[model samples]
Target: MSLDFAKLPKAVASRLAKLGIRQPFDLVLHLPLRYEDETHLYTIADAPMGVPVMVEGTVEHADITFRPRRQLVARISDGSSELFVRLLHFYPNQQQQLAEGKRVRLLGEIRRGFFGEEMVHPKVRSVGSETPLAEALTPIYPTVNGLAQPPLRKLVNQALNHCVLDDTLPEVLRHDLGLMPFDAAVRLLHQPTPDTAQRALSERTHAAWLRLKFDELLAQQLSMRLAYRRRREQTAPSLRATGLLAQQLLASLPFGLTGAQTKVLAEIRHDLASTHPMQRLLQGDVGAGKTIVAALAALDAIEAGHQAALMAPTEILAEQHYKKLSQWLAPLGIEVVWLAGSLKPAAKAAAIARVESGEAWLAVGTHALFQESVSFARLGLAIVDEQHRFGVHQRLALRGKGGSPHQLMMSATPIPRTLAMSFYADLDVSVIDELPPGRTPIKTRLVNDARREEMVEQVRKVCSEGRQVYWVCPLIEESEALELQTAIDTHVALSESLPEYRVGLVHGRLKPAEKAEVMAAFARNEVQVLVATTVIEVGVDVPNATLMVIEHAERMGLAQLHQLRGRVGRGALESSCILLYSAPLGEVAKQRLKVIFETTDGFLIAREDLRIRGPGEFLGARQSGVPMLRFADLERDTVLLEQARDVAGTLLDHHPAVVEAHLDRWLSGREELLKA
Candidate 1:
């Protein structure tokens, strides 16, 4: 029978709905955040001090007091000892419930009050002759503002009592995996026996967490694998990599491709030559020549008499790709068109026409490229840069433009192996593990605010040597809310401190045209020192800008700091990155700075980033169409992920019916994400 939220009380249902609990199954899966041991009740005098304890007593006196502030005080006695109950905020119902001679149960940490031992804002419930108390550890769930723990816990217990969940995993597989049964795992997770180790259950060290984590991991893997199978079933144009355009573009380049780049390009070539659609994720560190590899891949599609589109998240990045690709392909007799949201009507229309008429073999633009008005004549490949910034639906939309054209996604933010296995399981991944030759390594150092004069002198000297500098501020403008330095204030300070050099400012708040103008001036060396935010992190590639001073660098993440540092060291000159931090650096901030100063490897930094800031913060909540993982910790449960992948493959090969059952049980409503 289907469960209904309407059957619940009106107020209770509203609060539960806010917590995303609409059905009984939702309640069944609503696990407790923690467990409080409220099994043993003691008199107020016998309760353990400074420890969470349960006490039972009868109210002797209750009234409102105003010595320090508005307060409600209730003196309760257990016939042998007296205790005080303090309530800062109380309802009239609670006041009546705590009237004289009324028995009550209280749970909170015991502390020595001014009068004696007491509990401030303790959880209270009026006891009656028929009321039965729970004798086990009480489960504490995440609750809404208007909801309390008692009702929520009772609802979950009620759901559990009526739930008849079937075991989803195959019998043999479950036995081999040594996993607990589905119902048993849920029951134990919610209500362990009094003898169960409180520490183990509360810290998720018990075997139950492993079983649930495996279950969740297996479901995710099966979904992604099924999605991969479905995508391959869809036919796509098999564009041969003839190397006509790719070879020409390579020959025009000043340097040779690194071995890693060559290997990844060969893989892409193999994928393109196949009849099946190519869904590959190309991961490269900053300055590892990912764009060049993408450009080469696009050229193969163009040479095969098909159009190719490269989409970026921002217009600046789109324009950067446009300029670079145009320079490489225009000389080889290939038409390159740029389409952006800010383009003039005439220019956009012409660009659209060229794309539709197959006059332009290569098109580079932002999200505007995927608009309904724009259509490709015969698109063979679609390249998306900074793939994480774009959603899975956006990728599907872009690929739909060409009837499932070969999709190649490039990301400068290198994903750790755990994330790659779980999140990018659907797509084939290729890592460019090598940087091009002659790319200088950036020297990273941390400087405190007291060394401001020394850092300023360093910037002035770098600018005097005919090179530029980047002074990055964390915030755009001065705000009373945050103490971080702002670009506006920094620009003014830098311009005044170094009057001989040109200082230009750029931030996200600037108009596109204005921002583009400032970036262009910086690129042209008109601005010797560009004071900006992270707007220049991904796109701006100025060889003359060799020095970068990031103020309040500790405020940024490891991945972002690495990207900003990558802005320098593109040229042959030795580059330096000074991280100006505030005084009294925190442990995490100090570790971040040390990691950047120690190693320049993007993959190492990415792994460290994942370790420091879990998967949720590292990969955003809406990274893809797939639902955010709630049970499995990607950092700790990678072994489970690997096992799940193997089990999923086996099930698909040998036990297809069970696979469907597993997916239906765990991911019934999320089937569309796999297809996406």
Candidate 2:
């Protein structure tokens, strides 16, 4: 038998297409979400509470009533006890179907209701007393709107019976790894025995699920390994780290490098000295001194007579890097050039000319660094800060500007262990885990909006003690205009309330000069209170600022909250961050607030964030550029990931035939252009 999705009904084909299922293989991989138990019937009293179960009883009566709102209410009796059925919205025929003396089957959760024991909006149908129960549990698959479950199940069944599912992993290998055969795993997952543990299946921890996840992870690892091998095959300049420039700058700094920073810099230096372009991800928690490490990396490239460039996601962050790097490198007689969208034409022209002439040893800017007009004379290294905020193509474009420059991607947002293992498997990752000494941990507090006045008073008190404060407004949904308005309103409110202190406003709408002025004043302690938007979430540093009051903290993610909190604790005056949230928080918002309030560990917060939000949203722009895992849960399938990673290397080396077939089946067209 053969399955042709294109020849199927247009509606069915269109719905399947909506789910990225274009072929028989896709349908086969589209597995069940959960199973509905219909093989056994439970009486009203015997049916478990808060779980789906099959129940059959005779309808004693059915009527439409207005207990407060109009609804169809019915009572079902199993000869001993009764259960109420409420349908807030129902058709007239549904009432007739459930009229008195009718025997019907109900499949839904049972719980105590407003009136009595009830199952609201359950699957309802009339049935004869002699009707037999199902022989197996019904498989409920994931579907989109306008596609019903019955049709989806029929499509999956067709695909399963007709689609050819060959085992990609060798039988000997599967046995060695304690994995089930591919066909058996698929069949068991689609049609499990009644004795199978529901919890294991639901949580994807069953043996059958293990095979699927392992295969998926193995495909991803194989793809990444191929990418890594391809990069190694290409040639790049070996920027030997003579340390002539790097050492001189390190000694010039007033502060000493942390041990973690030293270790990461050594790893990067080793990579830069290699023949192949270094594709490494540098992850450090906020304020871990990544800038200095990046500076040193750039210095190595310059010392080896190769130019380097650094790209940031925002102008503010780019300027911050330009200033810091200039302060460090200018004294060493290595000139630095700044290129940005905000630069005047003559200034931008001069920067471009310097970069083109190789007079500027290192260039720093926002996305403008990758613009076609900006050219690099001998680009050897490219560093991207806040790498996640930019899409995969943007990073690729930057890398393309150089003749295969050694790329260093930096992120202050800590990547969780599972993510680093799975998504970033191809790159050599270096982490700066420890902070420098004398920095006090920021105390995180969750306060309600009603206490806004008290927080105002707290800000007043903190500033009166000769420290500064940052009061941030929530991100607006539709309107940048509205977001700017909110910032302006907050700035006005703070200034009026605290008349004795100098309050300054800065937002994305502000001119660069104005924004820089406000920031410099705050750093100088002239502006006691700074009100701004999330623009400051990345690059602002004020040691004197000891208090941070974020409005509507529930509206932000764990990473943003962590970054915002980091802005305050840079000083040693016992900093604190107050997260002010409004009422009626959603489940995700509550979780974000709780995670931010309880722990300051970025890695722990990242793990919780991944759990709260899945990998697609968590990976941000990388989702479009990488083949993401759809079936595997990173947090739960770490062991399988480890096994697959080992197997990927094995298959690539010994079973090359098996590698082609496996990659063809899983990642055929989904391979990302993940150059960086």
Candidate 3:
């Protein structure tokens, strides 16, 4: 039976919608935040202080008093002792409801008041013959405005009563895994005995919870596995590396490829040579030489009589890639085209024409490359940098520009192995786990904001030494709401503080041309100090720039802090990252700064970030179209994820019907998006 939300009261429907509850299953899935032992009641005399208790008593006196600040006061007795109930704010109707001789039930914590033991603002209701009470532990669910606990509890109970579920896991699998049946697990979770509820809520390790979490994870894994299977079934162009162009490009590079890069590139080359399209994730720490591997892949595609397109998250990064690729490939007579959203119509048309005619061997652009007007003669490879910035649909849209083009996604923010195994199960993974040789490890330190003058003087000292420096701020402009320093303000302040130094400013609000100009000045050594926002976190490359000062660094995420620090240490000179945080740091922020100060390993930072913020916020799931995990916590439930993956793979291979049913049940309409 479908529990139609439309049939509910208007206020109820709106409140439920606000809580993201629309379907019967959604209501059932909305588990209790906590459970209260309302089944047992205690008399006023016997009730312990400082503990929440439920009590039934007869009201002896109730009135509104004005002397002590307009409060409502009531006295109640349970035949043994009297208790005081005080409400700092109450309506006249509540006073009448608790009038003399009326029986009432209340739940609240008992505390020593001015007069005697009292329950301030206790939940109060009239006791009548028709009043129903829970015989077991009462569930307390999360609620929004206009939706109280009683009504929400009732609605959830209604949903549970009407819910009809069919077990999707095979009996043999359940027995072998020692798992409880699905229906039993659901019932146990929603309505458990007092003891079970206490254990489950307190520890969050009950067998019922384990059963439900595993099922949810299994659904996600099955969806991604199915997507992988379907993709493998499709045919793709085999782009083999003839070694002529790749060897030429490798020889031109002044430095040798790291062992990790070589190994990952070999994996990519093998995938490209296969008939199946490549859905690969190339992950590495910041400055781990992923771009070279990407370039090699592009060269392989170009040598195979096909064009390659590399799309970055931002125009600056795209331009960076375009410049680097051109410098590497122009010597070999390979033409590279640039496409961006900010390009003039004429320029864009010319670039598109080059791509269409196959005159452009490699196309480097932002999201503009995936536009409908931009087409290629033989687009065989598609490379997406910072893959987290784009959704799965955008990837598909770009792939549509070619006939199952080999896809290679690169992320500087190293994903934890567990996350890659479960969340990215659909894509084959190749990790460049090593940094290039001779790249100095960035020395990081936490500088308190009280030493702002000292830090400014230090920047000047670094600039006086002929090295460039970067001052990164979290905000672009000052906000009256937040007192955090802005990039513009910092630029102005530094310009005044160091009048002799050339300081340039760049932020996301600037026009593309303006940003490029400012960055160009910094690159050419014309600007000694460049103040910018986090826009430079990914793409800016300057060999002479060796110092970075991040103001209010505690306000930034660990992944972002790591990325910003990566901007430095790219050159031969030793680099230092100073995290200028305010005096009072939150515990999490303190830990984040400590992590950044301790290690330059991006993978460790990612794991710590995941542990601190959980998976959704770490990957930016809301913006990136990463499926929101409702039941499973990636940090705590990693074992469940692994077990679910194993079970999903086996079921898909052996019991496809059961796997499909399970996916349909848990994921419902989200199976397609979960493929990412």
RMSD vs true structure, all candidates:
2.0, 3.6, 2.1
Over the stretch 1-676, how does candidate 3's per-residue lDDT look in tens digits?
A: 4577778888878889899887877787788777777777788889988977988899999888888688988999998798889999888788888889999998999999886889999988788745667666877787898898888877888888887766888898898888888888877777877667476554667888888888888887888888899889999999986879999999888998888998999999999999899999999988889998999999999988889999999988999999999999999999999999999999999999999999999999999988889889999999999998887787778988997989999999898977887678888999998888889988998988998999999999999999999999999878888799999888989999999989999999999999999999999999999999999999788989999999999889999999999999997899999999997889999999999999988889999998998777777666555456777888788888989989988998899889878876777677666544
Best candidate according to TM-score: 1
| Per-residue lDDT of candidate 1, residues 547-653 (tens digit) | 99999988889999999999999989999999999978899998898898899999999999988987777775576777667788887787888999899999988
Show where candidate 2 strays beyond 4 Å: 8-14, 42-50, 55-67, 73-85, 92-104, 110-118, 126-133, 344-350, 438-450, 476-486, 509-514, 571-574, 581-600, 611-614, 621-624
On the 0 to 100 scale, the lDDT of residue 418 in model 1 is 90
lDDT of 2 by residue, 357-456 (tens): 9999999999999999988899999999988888888898999998799999999989888888788888999999999887899998999888889999
Ranking the candidates on TM-score from highest down gives: 1, 3, 2
Each candidate structure's count of clashing pairs: 0, 0, 0
lDDT of each: 0.87, 0.88, 0.87
Cα miss at 529, model 1 (Å)? 0.6
Question: What TM-scores do the predictions have?
Answer: 0.96, 0.89, 0.95
lDDT winner: 2
2 against 3, candidate with superior lDDT: 2
**Candidate 3 to native Cα RMSD, angstroms:** 2.1
Question: Residue 400 in candidate 1 has what lDDT?
Answer: 87
Higher-ranked by lDDT: 1 or 2: 2
Off by over 4 Å in 3: 5-18, 66-68, 129-132
Give the TM-score comparing model 3 with the true structure, all chains together.
0.95
